[model samples]
Target: TNASPSNTQTPEHSPTTIAVVKGLAWLFGSGSKTSTAIRETRTAYDLCAKRDNEESKFIHEVCRLSPTYQTWFQIANLHVWMVRTRYRALPAPYGKAFEQEFVNHFFLDIEDRMRAALNHKAPERIVKGYLTEMRDQWMGATFSFDLGLVGSDAELSGAIWRNLFASRGLDGKGELIGKPGKIGESRAVADGKAALAELPFHLYVFSAYIRRELKRLESISDEDVMAG
Candidate 1:
């Protein structure tokens, strides 16, 4: 008797294939994603060669394609700083500044990693694997916008306390926790204000990265024109 097709078999999607599709979707979801990536790199390259804005340059260069992996390694150290500074008590202005810088650095690093994946000479499967890893890490508890330092219980507690105190305009000493009745009502307003400031920085960073990538693509297209 002829064997029948197995009805019990489930459809299989290879992880690598799924990853490539996901990465491509992420890459193309925005109209200017490629351009933003190029712009961020260009700015970093400009800053790096000039040796000015060294810290910003440092953050951007960490993920730049280069002979050394020092930049990548340095990026791996940023989460600690994110955790500590975000949790520490500071003046409102300083806290705002630190939060902006933290987000700026985060996107710069992410853009760099994505750029690396794009530049990798390995097979598409390997490239997609790298992108998939990024997606997985981001989807997990290690990263988030509302909460800084997602996985660390201590960091989370510290962030909550810091936010609570900051919302009340109190120093870490808790002096002003309940003094200002109008502002002491709720953290909701404070969080809303913070979100307004924080969200824009992230968008700016991502936009800059995409702009940079588009420029690179344009340059390559130009070269192709000249050669052709």
Candidate 2:
């Protein structure tokens, strides 16, 4: 049957509209490939939380001081540094190319999630600033561990204590306080030594978890899927 001109006309989406829709879907879609990255990151957090011993006491305390989201960020930063250091120390089987690709995608996915969660576009300057700060922290952490690696046990302990406490010692009641006195300082040093004693085992566990997750990520067939 013949229809009126208006009834027969079909609406077509403009290229701009199509691109915007696709971009939105890519950004906020439920079936995003970034889901895997996010899941694995949460698993890392779970790994940190599951350890309940002297080896993990410092981590637990740090996590306790922050809210859940902040703890996740802290864990993510530490994991990123640990993974990078591990790969650098012992080259990955897939080589540096794959390592670089994976790390790049990991943070890109994290940034996307952050933007979506905030429900607003973050300024490029601000994002770059944060990335720079994170990089600085990563380098600082690597340098601290390097010093520990080559130095005496006391040096290693001191490094650990400085990092965990951020140079501010905690009181007996777990309250954050100023620099410790002589006896308090001694106690903190002793605590660091105890933690350092178990650092090797803790690092082993951390390395294993990250390696497993990264391998899982590497197994993704579509490289572009993770390139977000």
Candidate 3:
């Protein structure tokens, strides 16, 4: 997906830009020190706050351009997830302040748009369902964070698999298929689309959480997976 260029550019010929382009080149077909540095820096963050920013931005773009029922749900869910996990990590008053800033800048406006999309009965259930998904993602995020703090590869891998599977909405019984909705709708069913539309937000959050978790695992410095 083409990310709309930010009004703020890192400078076309500057180190960051050169590094990003070169890093993409390597990511597509090779490897390099710059790419490694980028990976390591991302690993250093608890999760990719940057990627969260991008995902939030992408959802906003979708909301603005397509504002479908599903896109509205997606945008709303992503905002809620950001508030729970990434926003929680910010320091002191700065965290709350930054979170409010994001809401004011993007999410609050999206909420209004979503409200307009809802029929006679406000889609409170849809919003609540998205919140539930956020809660689950936060739980998985915490699990991953703990794994990093403890530096346990076994725990990390196991937790990652569990998180990934659960995020997909499967259960031990194999009866629960697809992500949960606020109301009793299934993404599997046609009417479930209204319910599932915002589900991509949950998927997006989980994927970001997992990516950060894997990077944390890789940055563990001395873990030898083969030795296990």
- Tell me the TM-score of model 1: 0.24
TM-score of each: 0.24, 0.41, 0.30
lDDT of each: 0.34, 0.41, 0.37
lDDT of 1 by residue, 181-212 (tens): 21122222224345434433443453344345
lDDT of 3 by residue, 137-183 (tens): 54455556466435654454444334332222233232214444322
Show where candidate 3 strays beyond 4 Å.
1-96, 103-117, 123-184, 188-228
> What is the Å distance of residue 210 in model 3 from its true position?
5.1
Give me the overall lDDT of model 1. Answer: 0.34
Cα shift from native, residue 152, model 1 (Å)? 9.8
**Best TM-score among the predictions, by candidate number:** 2
- lDDT of candidate 3 vs native? 0.37
Compute the lDDT of residue 99 as modeled in candidate 2. Answer: 33
What is candidate 1's CA lDDT for residue 136?
50
RMSD of 3: 15.6
Clashing residue pairs in candidate 2 are none
